[model samples]
Each structure stands twice: as C-alpha cells, then as structure tokens.
Target: MSGGSKLWGGRFQKPTHELVDQLNASLPFDRRLARHDILGSLAHVTMLARQGIVPLEDARAIAQGLRVILQEIQEERFVFRLADEDIHLSVERRLRELIGPAAGRLHTARSRNDQVALDFRLWMREAILEVGEGIVETSQALLDLANEHRDVVLPGYTHLQRAQPLLLAHHLHAYVAMLARDLARLQELYRRVNRSPLGSGALAGVPYPIDRAFVAELLAMDGILENSIDAVSARDFALEFLADLAIVMAHLSRLAEELVLWSSSEFGFIEFDDAFATGSSIMPQKKNPDVAELLRGKSGRVFGHLMGLLTVVKGLPLAYNKDLQEDKEGVFDALDTVALLLRVLPPMLRTLRIDRGRMHTAAEQGFTLATDVADALVRAGVPFRDAHEAVGRLVAYCIAEGKTFGELAADELVRFHPRLAEIVFPRTVWDAVRAREHPGGTGPEHVARALEASRSELERTARWLQQERQRIDEAFARLLSEEFP
Candidate 1:
C-alpha cells in the first residue's frame, strides 16, 4: 500500500485501491449536490462562529471560501473529482487547497454523516417545492381543459366496457382530484424533509456546545432531528417522496393510457396535437400517440426507483452505513422522471383536440342510460333489485336484436316490466345525460359545479405552492445574508 490523500488517511497504511476508488465514488451522479453541500457547510461554519467553536476570523475565511466554491459550481466552473468520493469531500478538499489551513477548521464539530444529510434535505426541500409546483400546474391544466369542455359528455367505463355516461369535465376532474391528493402528499413530505439533521454529527451528537436550533433556523428548517443515530440513518423521507412521485406518475399513466386509447381511430375521443404525436417509419398512415405512450411507459422507472430505494433501506440497521450511499441515485431518477413527465404533459393536454361528437356518440351506444332507466323504474315503484334485473334483461334483449336503448319504443318497454312502460325514458343522448340529476353526477349542471370546485381547488393549491416557494426563498436569503438573526 502507498500514496493516498492524507485527508482521511492518517490511520491508513496504503493508498485506496484504484478499483475501490472508482467503485466507491458517487461524483458521477451526486456532483449536482455541490451547491447544497457548500450551503450546508456555510450554515455549519456560521453556527461555529456564532457559538465561538471556531475563531471568528477562521469562520469568516471558511464562509467566504465556501461561497466562492458555490459560485464556481453554479457557473459550471468547478472541477469534480472521483477520488473525493462524494460532494462533501470534494468541497472540503477544494476548500483546503483554496484557503490554506483556515479551510482545515471548516469541518470542526461536523462529520460527513450529518453534513451530507443536511445537504440532501436542503436539496430535496427545493426539489419537493419544484415537483409540487409541477403537480399544481398539471392540475390547473386539467381544470382549464375541463372548463373548456364543460358540456362534452363521454362514456364512463367499467372493465374497459362503457358502463355509463359522464361529462368529459367529470373525467378530467377525476384526475384533478387524484393530483390534488398528490399535491397534499408533497406538501406533507416537505414538512417532514424540512427538518435539519446537521447537528447529529457522525452517529453520536457533536460535543462542541453547538446549538442545533441555531443551525436549523439558519437553514429555515422545521426543527432538529432529535436522535443523532436516526438523524443520519433515516431515509424514510426519500421513500415517502418516491412513494408520492410513484402515485402521481401512476395517475399520469392512467391519463396517458386514456390519451393513447382516445387518439386511436377506433376511439377517436381525442386527437393529439401534431407536435405531441408521432408517425410510423414503416407506415406513413400511422399517427401514433408516442408522447402519451412514452409517459405511460416512463411510470415503470418511477415505480422501479421506488422499489429500488425501498429495498435498499429495508434491512439496514440503526445509525449510518455505507449502504446508505445506495439511496440518492434512485431518488434522483424518480425526481427527474416525475419532473419531466409533468412538464411535458400539461402543455400536451392544453393542445389536444377533444372529439365531442365521438365522445357523445360513444356514450349513447353503451346503454349507459340503462342505469337511468333502472332508476326511472325505481321511481315508478319497481323494487330496486327488480329494476336492476329489468334493466339487465332489457339490455340483453336490445343486444340480441341489434337495437339500442333509444330504439326501443314506449310500447315495447312494457314487455320487460309494466314499470318500464310507465316510466318516461330519455329520448336522445343529451336527454339521457341530463336525466341523471344528482350532486357529483355526470349531468351537465353537476359537472359545472364540480368544474368550479376544481377551479377553486386549483387556485388554492397554486397559492399554497407560492407560499412554500416564498418560505424557501426567504430562508435562503437569511442563510446567505450577513445578518444571522
């Protein structure tokens, strides 16, 4: 064994093995956290100065040095090193080389354990805000689409078979409901992630008479992670985040699958914008829903990333371990996937052409009004089960005769049950759609009310996201400013 940097090697007899160095390095992916690492270092060093743990002059020098590195990274001028293993070491390595022995004091009372944890939380806080905004904007787009097509009625499906009639706004609003819950999950996760883990030091708490609250406040976090071992070892925040992302992506995939189905000639419920669709290489006639299809496919990776991270943390014991290094890559992948899909989808949806005529035609053909007819029978004193049975028999008879519900004459209805003849069935598709008058029903009046409610929810969600962003911005300003209060 031979020559390695003396930074962490005072006790070692040999240089780190070349293969091990390459294998252990996270620089390829985690170099993106350089600014976050420096931000964490700045907070830590500022705390050190505040508490007189390090000389004021040395703390000032370290602070300025870390700020300079942060600027370099932002400008894409910083040189990342594989030998440094990860961002924390790389920043400290560069700091030592930049500011001489003053840089040596930068690590005082801090370990890469808690330092990296703080940096990661900072990064994910911003990430959550960003992804939350994406979810909000996506919901807003759905609201806009629903608002645009308020009167369009489409077939609602069960087991991929048209089972009832629903307004297109109702369908779009269903996704908005799912996305609203997703946004709520992201908001909750942000609070969980916003707690600072910096003062936990390595595994045991640092013994420098340092104030964890001071550092946490400076970082604009909720509070400190009280247990040192849990502070550095816990990755449930990442798991929770991935879980949120996977669910959102699953929702997106469902919408995407519908888009794929709807854009086809067979369904023709929607048509993709030219920019949002693709053509086949072999068949010039083929206009494929590739973008929507791809988003649907992308859910696999988000799902895989969630499972990957869950597996990584499942058996790990308390306190930090190198196994924890397995965490960020999966998280990063899921975050990137979610962010990209959300960004592309809103615009694509805004430009899509809804085929109101096709949707209306499909809704009418499905015997969706059978429920309305059954309900009508119930109103006419047919027992509820008998009404359902009566409707089922009527539908089977119509299918056997190659006729629709609309084709059955009033006189023909008496054969199913006398109650069927007594009831006034809706004559046209619109008549059938309008007959289902109930709150949250696909009736035009109800869908309009739902649309307004979704609009209100979208506005509220947007405001909530803006407040979250403002809080982060204000915190960063405090962290970067000369005043520590």
Candidate 2:
C-alpha cells in the first residue's frame, strides 16, 4: 500500500510505500519533543507577527492553538500519529485542526530543519540544569556522609593494596570533587546550548524580516546562532552533553564500586540498607549489593551512548540530514539514567551503616604508618633515602619474626639504624592521620574545613539551578499566557 504524507504530499503524484513510512517516521521517539516543539512554535509565531510576516490575529490564534496542544500533551490527551512523521508535524497537524488556516502561518519563517534544531536545543537547556541539580544533590550527599564519619580512618589503596591511612571523610570528599567538576562542565555547556536557531529556515537565512534575536529573547535564550547553516546543522552541544554525562557516570561508577567492595563480608567496612540490597533465590544467606552493582555496570551503557553519537556525527554532511535524528534517543536515555542514579544513590548512601571499628582495624593492619616513622627519622637528621631504606629493612625484619613494629624491642630496632632506638614510632592509626595537619590533608582539622567549603560550594550550585529554572519557567509561562498581542 502507498499513501501521501498527510502534511507534506503536495508535489508527490504517488504516495510513499508503507514500508518507507515505518522506516521514515520519527513520531515514536521524537514525540518526546512535543512540549519543546510547542514552546518553540509559540516563540516563532510571536516573532512572525511582530515582523508582520503573519497577521496579528492569526498569530494570536496560532498561539492559542499551541497552548491547547501543550496542555493536551501535558495532560496526556494528545494523540501522536505515525503519519505525521515527527513532533513538528504532529503539532502542526493538530494546530491546523484546532484553528484552521491561521495554524499554517505559525511556520511561515521556519522549516522543520531549524524547527527541530530549536526544539532539541530547548530540550537540552532544560536537561543540563536538571543534570546539574542531580550532581549537586549527589555531592551534598557525599559531603553529608563524610561529615557523619569524620573521626573514622581507613586504609587508602594504590593498585588494590593498602598503602596509606586516611580519614574516611577525605576519601568521600574525593568523589565530591569529581562531581563538582561535572557540574562545572554542565554550566559551561549551557552557554553554548542557550542560543536560538529558529529563524534559520531550511538552510540559508529566511527571506522574511525575521528577528532571530527577539525569538531568542522570547524563549529565554542568550542569543541567536549566527550562521544560518550552522544553526540547523550543529549537534556538538549534544555531543558535549553526552561526553559530560559519561564522565558523571564514571565518577558514580567508582563510588558504586567502592560501596560494593566495602559491604562485602571480606572487607566488612559498611553494610547496605536492606532497601538497597537484594537477596538471592538459591543462596539462603546472600544479601547482594545489587543497586551498587547496577550503578557500576551502567557506566558502560552511558559510555556506549557517547561513542554511538560520535560515530553517527563524524561523517555527516553540511546543513541537516535525516541521520541527525539518531541523536535524541541516546541523549534521552543517558540523561534519564544519570537522573535515576542521582535520585537513588543519595538515599542509599544516607542509609548505609558504617563499621568504624572494622575500618580503623584495617587502617592499622597494612604497615600504613611506615611513612610517618620514616619522617620521624628525617626530623632526627637522617637523610630521607637512608630513612626509607632503613624502614624497608625494619619491615622485612618484622615480617620474618612474625611481629609488628610495636612488638620490636629497642635492641632489635637499633640493628637497622641507631636513630631508630630513640625514635617514638606511631603505632596507632590516629597518630598517622593527626601528623598530617596541612591544608587538604586527612587531618581532622583540615577535613573539617574541607567539608565546610564543599557544603558552601554545593549550596552555590543549588542556588544557580533554582535561578536558571525560574528564568526558563517564566519564559514558558509568558509564552503560554492568554494575552498575546
């Protein structure tokens, strides 16, 4: 069977094949842009009327019709037709039905090329802020956890072997630092995504006296995309978003990996809340850290989306292509996945029980205080390299005799270096941690200051999100108002 495209069949003598319709239609996925499409159209139609390209009365009618459609979609009353091909046409077809011929004038100075580009950028502008909020929430959660466990010390590892002792607060602060960078990346990317491309038309600039700047203002965009061709063609904003999302997932996956390890029977440093853990069907005693495992596993999923978009975009020709349609779903999924992780992770972290005794014991078991002992020798006028070599031999001697440094007699210690007989070794984990009182160190006073600074940073990011959200909401509220001139 063959049929003409309901919205674009004027020149076709014969209709498209049914198979082509299924292959060509983007209504299923691109329909996610319905709200964004209406919002963009509202701005475009208002601009058209101001420039005298569309009659004022007709612009008012089109704006009314778009508001109705927006409400329909919001309330789940709108129908999506595959024959309409995409969100742009679906809204157009419905607008025509609602207000007759005036709806047609709404698109007078725009084409689906620039229209979709506008909708996508609008969508991303909102999404970037939303992701920023998530990052803030996650960072705040980590900071809260660090504050709650400020006195605990744990073995910090390199190459999976315990190498040094650190405050657990310092370890959690590392993730907070990574998330702050993720938030910064989104804030930077927002500037690029905030430009309007609506008046670019198909490829070359529209012939009408369209005011791109006014449309951008109406939509709360920062400015117009300067080049008409680039306006409809550029997708680097989305690529950058995906790239930032991949980094976010990488940070989250690291935290999740640590959670999984810490909750295990062998490590026993923490326990997941029952709500965040799962029980096995066959194993009677298996309480699995499934949520953490899933969080860790989903990082690759986001990474794959980033790679997929890059590959799709690498060889694209100038202007627009149907190939550009491949961009949305990956972005949608990646954002949704990151949002879900942020929502669940904070609660999971807040509920987990920390075994401070286990962490402190582990901190002491790994010869973690050796560096502090070597430093003590350096303070006694022994060269650092000599101090390190002497400490290394002392460790070997303790291992051979099946004794710890605390168990070594003064006679035994003096065999390595005469100064070792007089040096008071740091046998407790607190001794090692308290010795590092410099800024950004694992010392109690420094961790306390860092926690306060991190909390302040998180508060600033939250305020930024709230203000940006208000700006966008006010723009849409004005666009949806009944009084359109």
lDDT of 2 by residue, 1-485 (tens): 01246456677777778888888788899898898999888888888888888989899999999999999999999998898888888898999999998777877988889999999999999999988988888888889899999999999999988888999999999999899999999999999999998888888988889899998998999999999989998899999999999999999999999999999999999999999999999998999999999999999999999999999999988878888888899999999999999999989999989999999999998688888889999999999999999999998998888888898899999999999999886888898898889987889999999999989988998998899999999998999888664
The alpha-carbon RMSD values of the candidates against the true structure, listed in the order shown, are: 2.3, 2.0
Worst 10 residues of 2 by lDDT: 1-10
Q: Enumerate residue pairs that collide in model 1.
A: none
| Candidate 2 displacement at residue 319 in angstroms | 1.4
User: Model 2 residue 202 lDDT?
Assistant: 84
Candidate with best TM-score: 2
Q: How would you encode candidate 1's per-residue C-alpha lDDT over 27-101 as one tens digit per residue?
A: 898887887787777788888898989999888888878877888888988888787878878888888888998
For model 2, name the residue pairs that clash: none
TM-score of 1: 0.96
Off by over 4 Å in 1: 1-6, 482-485
> What TM-score would every model get versus the actual structure?
0.96, 0.97
